[model samples]
Target: MRLVRGALRAWRDSFDCGGRSVAMWFPGHMAKGLRQMKGKLQKVDCLVEVHDARIPFSGRNPVFQEALGVRPHLLLLNKMDLADLKEKSRILEQLKQEGLKNVIFTDCEREENIKEVVPLITELVSSNQRYQRAENVEYCIMVIGVPNVGKSSLINALRRLHLKKGKASQVGGEPGITKAVLTKIQVSERPVMYLIDTPGVLSPRIGSVETGLKLALCGTIRDYLVGEDVMADYLLYNLNKHQLFKYVERYGLDAPCDDIESVLKRVALKLGKTRKVKVLTGTGDVNVIAPDYNAAGYEFVRTFRKGELGKVMLD
Candidate 1:
């Protein structure tokens, strides 16, 4: 990576949001999900909030805390395999300061730390007051988070780990996979534990544009809403800032670059992700090959999302 650093242009000190507002995509389904979740909160014993480990600090819906804060809460930062956690201690400290004392970093794919979830939830619920359901032995836990942060995967993982069962919930790369609060699925036979899955909700009012971009980059939000090209550019800016030049080697670039176009051009050419366009020649219109910037941007963003570039800490 250092081989490309000497010739690399000065990295961006700060990202410019370019007067873009935080993507406020609280669609009807999200609003409906929130209402349904609140309506069912009375029966829920605990709230297990899942989120992308890459952006642990950003994009958490404040509405969850305000409306459903009465229940025992456990924050699960899912997809830990894709995050840079050199400062995990600091992340936990900050979360503790913010009143999220019960936090767990999890990766559903490898089932990393999956076994600890039940014990931790049991402890948290046992220590806290269970409101009106004190006599109930079966624990009902609700999983909530922004879209595409592995809410369904966590439920499926728990079911697979504890019950030795197949998928209990649907998993997808896009947001809004679960449109409503799903029927509670039994994950454990011993404790009689059940989990409720809900559609990922976004806060109507985000903290900042940078926070929104981070969420978008993490696939918590739709790519089209943020514009693929712009998302790719912002991603490039971030990769350069962190000195993560895996793109240089992956895309066969000579060195790390600050310009998004140059890097994407190489990506498009190498991947053969080009399109045909008609050029207005003097004699007549002729077809020509043009690098598909939008497709290249989409691929770039998706590659990062898959953690192929490198583990990144966007928060």
Candidate 2:
């Protein structure tokens, strides 16, 4: 309640570029009074839907489609840094199939990557709103995304990249950063578009075991939802039949088979000596076991990310 109010006040006090309207969009789980904010999106001329490149489907806002109801949207795939290049390509194709024509993959931390989307965003807004000299378009552009997926980072990068600093005030998130803000950036390229950056959202579906791990890796879910051993077990199970099982074989483990549990136990045993103890250590000295479970867990993630398990998308 308080965060939302504070954000609304900040936007109201900010200077207006034209007859434009902007507002922050956030997850339903983040705060109270959001239920009343529903149907408010109907007023926006264009929607800027932000999603993670890694798990696009899981990172999407469940209420977005319902709220917008045929409104035009520009889907921004943020955080290209952590995404698998192959998976990122596939996800973009999938989104096009899902009816999003305006899409841009960006790592807003770098200005070069950020500028590539300027022409695309400009074209989308111009086409959707169609501002003419005779009459003003009076635009409203809303930015929506899952929490901690770099929504604020994108907005901040936008201001800095465009050299419109000292003009916008963005709120900071609790236990995170940047709770909410809706600001206008004077884009000489895209004069008709009024930008609205909303608070990040963490949909409830992301609480699932696999999706949660993905979000945790993305820094969206901060708490230790899964321990090192549990995560390693998950990776082992998921990657048992993975396409790049050859990598495991390269490490001298047996070729992975259909039975995932067997593969994990084998991995545990194989790394036992590295951890300075036996997999089933009792009386044996602790200096001769495989890699510790925690270390093994990191290796699993590292290998998985490096395509050791093959082309996999945790969608």
Candidate 3:
């Protein structure tokens, strides 16, 4: 997509999260998942952390580094299809500077770049010290990541590639799809490899509201928790900031817009997302048809998530 350059109008420099606390967004189930993963750390040979490629620089749970970072790790940035990869090399370089040398971009749904996963895992484990597992020939890997980043999809993709098998884990579009640490599912046959799938967990204390919003935008967190209205606004802000104007054409707008309510109103009117509501007048009550802004906001956010508005780099 060719973005228009030159004198663009002003956009939001920052977003107001309405004083919503990060603690409210962190659910109890995620805490339990983290504890369960820690207990099974000793049995695993390598940690494959899957994350959304769009927000590569932010929204990662620090607990993964503090608790599970000791093992040989590979950071797999999933959902490559929805991310802007023009800056992929730069992103990798920044991650390398932070001591993360092993990284791969993958689209689990299409199973793109999945052929390289097994070999990469083998190389990482072989180069690192195996310790007590030196006598064991089979390899066991633990898949970890923030919520809804496609942990289960990656496992299923590997299984389809190596074992010629069907899904061993459940896949969904929302966060917290895998509720617990599941039993190991074999993905490769020749070298005898198995992967343990864990529920997506987030940090109990997120650093900032923007990080939380980014995670929410990527479906790492529940949409209602951050509010659909605010998320739609933030999405618009990022789209304009990056000069991604596909939304203007998609929603049938005459020009680019910064006001989320105005955009959503247009979307609601065009899509016929309206509801009849009773409003009291000075004389009597009358039913009036009004645009469902919530529904419109949801569709706007959904379109962006599906990459209909064009690829975005939220970091």
Candidate 4:
């Protein structure tokens, strides 16, 4: 799709979160899951943190890092297919400065770079003296990440690639799919490897609204928690900032848009998602067709999640 050539318009430099907080999305299950994960960490060999590649620098649950940082760690930035990774080296350099030397960019949907997982785990485990003393040949690994960042998808992909097995850990689009620490699922047979899939955990105190919005945009948090309208607005801001205008073609807009309500209204009408609402007038209340902004917002968000709107890096 060709983006229309139009005069550059001034877009909002930043998004106003309207005094919102990320405290709303921290459910009881998340805290329970974190405690449960620590209990089983005694038997774990490697801790793999699967996070969204789009926001490599944001929304990672610091609690996980603090509690489970003792083990040999691997940072697997999943969902690379949906991210615009124009400068991966820069991202790597930043992570390296932050003392993260083991990081892999992956697309669990297509199982890209999945084969590297088991080997890397093997190397990390072998190098670490703590886990290397194990008597059994079978290696038990643990998977951790914030919600909806493809933890289950990565496990399923590894199983598919290594063991030719199906998804033992259930997968879902919404957050908190795996509410508790799951039993070990086998993904390899040669060296006898197993993976313990844990619930995706978010930072108890989300740093700021911008960080929350980025996580919400990546579907790490629920839409209603962040107000779909504003989430869509922030998304629009990000799309324009990144110069990713695929939404223009997707929504049949004549040009790029800054107003999220207009874009969502267009999406609602285009998708035939209008609803009839009663309006009070001088005469009486009359039914009028109105665009379903919630539905449109959902569709717009889902479209971006599916990578139809374009590759975006929301960090």
Pick by TM-score: 2 or 4, better one: 4
Give a tens-digit lDDT track for model 3, residues 1-315. Answer: 666643466787877777875546667777888899999998888999999999887988888999998999999999999999998889999999989999999999899999999999988888886554454489999999999999999999999988889999999988989999999999998778999999998887778878878998999988876788888999999998888989887779888888988999989988999999999999999999899999999999998899999998998
In the order shown, the candidates' Cα RMSDs to the true structure are: 2.2, 15.6, 2.9, 2.6
Cα lDDT of model 4 by residue, 10-71, tens digit: 77788878887765677898899999999999998889999999999998888987898899
Writing each residue's lDDT as its tens digit, candidate 2 over 95-187 gives 789887667777766653777555565556566544432334545666676666666666667767665664353533221354544444443
Name the 10 consecutive residues with the lowest summed lDDT in model 2.
8-17
lDDT of 2: 0.55
Local distance difference test values of all predictions, in order: 0.90, 0.55, 0.89, 0.89
Q: How well is each residue in 1-315 modelled by candidate 1, as lDDT tens digits? A: 356444547888898888987556889999999999999988888999999999889989999999888988999999999999999999999999999999999999999999999999888888885454455489999999889999999999999999899998999989889998899999987788999999999998778878878888998888766778789999999898888989999999988888999999999998999999999989999999999998899899999999999899987
Off by over 4 Å in 3: 1-8, 18-20, 130-136
* Rank ordering of all candidates by TM-score, starting from the highest: 1, 4, 3, 2
TM-score of 2: 0.60
**Which numbered prediction scores highest in TM-score against the true structure?**
1
Worst 10 residues of 4 by lDDT: 1-10
How many backbone collisions does model 1 have? 0
